[model samples]
Target: MNTYLRILSYARPYSRFVPVYIVYTLMAIIFGLLNFTLLKPLFDVIFEQVDSEVLLSYQNKPDFTFSIDYFTHLFNYYFLQVAEEYGKMGTLFYVCLIIVVSVFLANLFTYLSGVVLAKVRAVVIKRMRTDIFDQVSRLHIGYFSSERKGDLMSKMTNDVQEVENTIVQSLRVVFREPATIILYFAVLFFMSVKLTLFTILIIPISGAIIGGITRRLKKKAVESQQSLGRIVNILDETLGGMRVIKAFNAEWFMARKFDEETDHYAAVNVNMARKNELASPISQFLGVTVVAGILVYGGSLVLSGESTLGASDFITYIIIFTQVLNPAKEISRAVSNIQRGIASADRIFQVIDTKSKITDPDTPLAFDSFQKEIKFEQVSFGYEDEMVIKEVSFTLSKGKTIALVGPSGGGKSTLADLVPRFYDPTHGIISIDGHDLKELSLADLRKHMGIVTQESILFNDTVFNNIAFGMDEVSEEDVMEAAKIANAHGFISEMEHGYQTNIGERGAKLSGGQKQRLSIARAILKNPAILILDEATSALDSESELLVQEALTKLMQNRTTLVIAHRLSTIQHADEILVVEKGRIIQRGTHTDLMQQEGMYQKLSSIQSV
Candidate 1:
């Protein structure tokens, strides 16, 4: 119940719709009850069961009162007058016309209530999905690393969609259905209090039976959602790594893995469906049994001549009581669906309630430009338990190019990531111009830096848009100039649409060198004061490498550059080269100075010379 209410609280400022919906729904229920209430008069007239004494009593208007009896008497008084003034056929037509009009108003108000509820559903979903997405966008990069992309995608898509389907469908059942049942039961009690009391006593038996079936549905629902996430994860991994799978001739292996997960997902859903499906039939059977009991009991009372329920009124009571089953069944079904919705809501709120570990301080320090050096003072970082970077310290003054040469898993990338505040250090302060990085707003800190990685992350967009990715309203001349600086202008012009050509997903349409050049172009357009290049040209061919290296040189000039490279030739000209091994800087000096030392740098330089 708490989870359901929490999910509903997203729909705020309900003053616009809730009151109007209440009025329409109440009118709908009242008129719908009127449809059943009129059945008694129509049956009495059809069977000619109206007593002559009762007819004469209805001629003089009964004194009006607040009770239902007063209203029934008032309607009967007018109905009998019409019958006497008109013929029997005319009275039949009059009663039928009233029934038709009541039915029409009932349906119309029902539709109006549905329209209002739909608007509320749409607003709730829009706000909820937007809030989930907003929280996701604000999360730290480390969150993505620790979580599956497909799992997150499932929460945003499948889980949220589940909440929409079940919760929105249950909304009407929660409000309108119970209101309908209550109004119908009120009429039943008014018709025959003894029979209504007997019927009410048996209703809880159906509820208890249905409740037992749906009790475990929530736990199964959670498992179903989780299994679906794993299936999505498998699908995503297969699609993203199709090249690797085919290259290794692992199609059968991938197929078997996918089948295993899908089989589990299917099994989980089957189990959930078994429980969910059982609730309806059990409730329905119990409802029919109760109705049968009511008929037998009420029939005896009428046969014994001890009840005020006339033949037509008893039939009307039975009709209205039977109508009660529909809403009761819907309520049972809604309970099952609400359980599923609560499970999905748990997953969605987990993401929304996640507190991002990386956030700017409440009172962040002011930072406009990089005037001095970036100093890492005894910085150490760990992923879980293992320290990846230990006591790492360095300083790169303005306009100086420093290269970090290291083997794989040597914390080069981790050290570079710290500069952009991707992950805060575990145990030290990284200060830029004597101001701690933690004290600066992330946006202000990253705005002055640009990064180009080996993967060359480019979106599937036009060349112009890709180059000017995050900027707003950039002029064409400026974009073209940035392309020229990155050595991408010539090839872009050679393409069929020049700057407007659509690059396929992740720049799939471009070659290795072209993609890297576009990445460099994007960085150049940002024109940050600090540049971080992580093996920018390591994956290209010789000719492509030369072109990309030239672009990098242009981008690195007159900037505080931090380069992480495996190729010894690329960093030999850097003002300083740090040889990092096992999370510590073993050597640090000018490239030539490091080469002169009989250490890791010289050995690596000698090996690359081969």
Candidate 2:
């Protein structure tokens, strides 16, 4: 219930529609009830059973008041007037005309209320989906690593879709169905109290049974939605790793995994369907039993002359009572659908409710530029009890270069990540220009630093857009200039559309060197005070390496640089070189200074020279 109400709360300004919708709905219900109630008079005109004394009494109109009695009496006053003026045939036509008008008004107001609900439905979904997207965007970088990409995608797409289909559609059913049943029963009781009371008792019994069944359906619904998320996860992994699957000939392996999830999804849905499907048949069967019981009980009253209801009035009561049954069945079905919708809602809220582990402080220090050196003091970081960076400390001053060369998993990249505060250290302080990184807002802390990783992160956009990414109001001339400095303008100018060419997903259309240079151009465009190049030219071929390395050198000029390199030649001219091994700085000195000694730096230099 909490989740269901939370979804409704997104429909802000409910005052815009709720009151008007209630009015339209009530108008529809009251007029619709008149249709059933008119049946009593319809029989009177046809059978010539209108009591002369009763007809005469109705001739004098009742004073109007805000009660059902006023409308009932007003309708009879006009009804008997038509009968007195004409014979039974004319009276019959009058009654038919009134019924037709009531039907028309009922349908017209129902449509008006539907329009209001449609607007609410559209607003509810738009806000709900937008909220999910915004929350996901603001989540810290680590959350993406710990959660499945496809499952998150499922919550944004499939889960929102489920709520729209089931919960939003139930808005009308939730409101109108119960109101219709309640009003219809009000009239039913007015005509035959004993019969209406008997149905009232039976209704709760059916409701209890249906409620029990739907509770179990909610559990199955949770399982079903979860299984569907895994199916999407498998599909995403399979699509993303098709190259690996084919290379390893693991087609059957992926197929087995996909098939298993789908099979489970199908089985769970079948179980849910069995329970959900059971509700309608049970409600309908119970409705029929109630109808039959009313006949035996109410018919005996009419024949024995123990009830105030005449034969015509009793028949009218039964007809109106039958209309109540349809809404009852709909209510049962709506409850089943709501269970599924709430299950999906729970999944969506799980993501939206997650508090980001990393956020800006309540009172952040001001930092617009890097004036001095960045210092790391006894910093350590770990992932779940296994330390990856331990007691690592280093300093890189303005207008200088510091390079970290190490083996894979030596925490070089992790150390670089700490500079940008991608992940805060588990212990110790990292201060920039005498301000601790945590004391500055993330936006201020990262604004003056640009990072170009080993893998160039390019979106599926035009070259100009990619170069100008994260910055607005960037003129094309500026983008072209930055590209020229990064050695990217040459290739971009030669393309079909030049800078306007749309690179495919992750720059799939571009070569590795081309992609790297574009990323460097993006960093250059930012003109950040500090640049972290994580082995920027390591993936390029010999010819492309020379081009990308030149661009890196240009981008690094007059800026503080923290570099991670696998190749020894790339950082040979660095102001200082750090040899990192097993999460610690094993050696630190100038490249030539380290080479003069017998160390990992000399050994690595010798191995690469071979």
Candidate 3:
């Protein structure tokens, strides 16, 4: 329940809709009750049972009082006057007219109340979803590596949708249902206190039964949501890896895996439905049992002439009491469904409550320019006790290119990752121009660096938007010039829409060389003071590699560049080369100097030459 209330707190500044909702709800309830209360006078008039002397005494206009009897007498006094002035048929028409008006006004106010609740529902969902998305965006890159993408996607899409459909819709049931039951009970008590007290005593039996059924529903609901997330994960992986599955002829394998998860998900929901569906009928049966008890006990009292309840008033009491059962039944069903919503809320708030491990420091050092060099001093990093980079130290002076050549899994990419603070070092310090990287704001620090990975990470967007990504107010000419320098302008112009053409997902519409060239164009447009290239040309064909390599050369000029080279021939002219092996730098020197020594760099160069 605390989690449910916390989710609703996102609907702030309730002054706009809450007060109006309250007004309309109250008006609807009052008029709806009047529809039942008017039944007493209606019965008395039809039976011709009005006492002339009593009616005459009430003719003096009784003073208004808080008791129900005062209002009843006040209504009867006017009714008797009309009864005397007109015929019996005229009085009947008059009473029927008032009932019709009361019914119409009751429904009108009910509709108005619904309108207000709709507005509140929209506002709450909009604010809650926006906050969840913002928190997910701010999380550190390592969080994604550890968490499943589909699970996070479920929190954003499926879980949020559950809150809207079940929880937000229940907001009215939370308030209006109880208020209706209470108001109807008040009318029942006014007619006969003894009968109302008897009804209240047995109501808890229904409550206890309903509570027992719904108590275990929350646990089941959580399991159901988790199973659904797993199903989503399977679907997402299958779609993303469709080509792999087909190439390996493993469609049956993938289909079997998905079928197992979805079957479990369907079974969980079936169990939940069994529990949720039981609450309504069980409560309704209990309500009918209570009504039967009232009929026996209250009917005996009137028969013995020991009770003041008239036949007409007793009938009205039973009518109002039966109406009370409807809201009670609705409340029971709502409690069952609310358990499902609370389960979803727990998943959503779990993500929103998570604090990002990477955040800006208070009073962080301001950094706008990069000068001199970037130095790693005895730097070491590990992922959960297994070291990837061990006490490695190097200095990358400005406007010079330093290349890292190594066998696979030798921490070349990990070492490059440290420069942008993607993962902070476990042991030592990395500084830029004499200032610690941790002391500067992350955004400001990253502003002067550009990165291109082995995978060409292009979006499904127009060529112009992809090149000018993350930048604001960039001119078209500037984008064109950058593309031209990266040698992408020729192919881009050949497309049907030129720069405005929509590239399919991850630039699937373009060739390998075209995609890499666009990536280089993006890096060149940023024109950062430092560049990190992680095997950027290794994935391309020989012809594609040549074009991409040419573009990379244009991007690397006048920048402090860190190259993780897979091909030894590409980095032979680097100002300095470090040969890394098994998380340690085995050798470091100029390319020519390293070639003179019979070491790992020489062996790797000889193999590539073959």
Which candidate wins on TM-score?
1
Model 1 regions lying over 4 Å from their true place: 60-67
- What is the C-alpha local distance difference test score of candidate 3? 0.90
Q: Residue 140: error of model 2 in Å? A: 1.5
Q: Write the per-residue lDDT of candidate 3 for residues 393-487, one digit (tens) a residue.
A: 99999999999999999999999999998888999999999998999899999999999888889999999999999999999999999999999
lDDT of 1 by residue, 1-610 (tens): 8889988787778798889999999999999889889998889889998788978888879886898888888999889888998968878898999989999999999999999988989988999999999999999988999899888999999999999999876898978899999889888877788889999998998998899988999999999999888888989999989999999999999899989988998998999999999998898899899989988999889889878898888888888988999999999999999999999999999999999989999999999989999999899999999999999888888999889987889999999999989999999899999998999999999999999999999998999999999999999999999999999999999999999999998899999999999999999999999999999999999999999999999998889999999898988889888889989999999877887889999998889889
**Residue runs of model 3 more than 4 Å from their true location after superposition:** 65-70
Question: Which clashing pairs does model 2 show?
Answer: none
TM-score per prediction, in order, is: 0.98, 0.97, 0.97
- The C-alpha local distance difference test score for the whole of candidate 2 amounts to 0.91
lDDT of 2 at 215: 86
Q: Give the per-residue lDDT of model 2 (tens digit) for 1-610.
A: 8999999998888998899999999999988998988888999877778998887878888997999888878888888888778878888999899899999999999999999999999999999999999999888787898998888998999989999999998999878999999899888878878878878887788899999998898889889888888988999899878999999999999999999999999999999999999999999998899899889988998899988899899889889989999998999999999999999999999999999877889999988778999999999998879898999988889999999998889999989999888888998899999888889998998889999999999999999999999999999999999999999999999999999999998899999999999999999999999999998888899999999999999998899999999898989889999999989999999987998999899999999999
Give the winner by lDDT: 1 or 3: 1
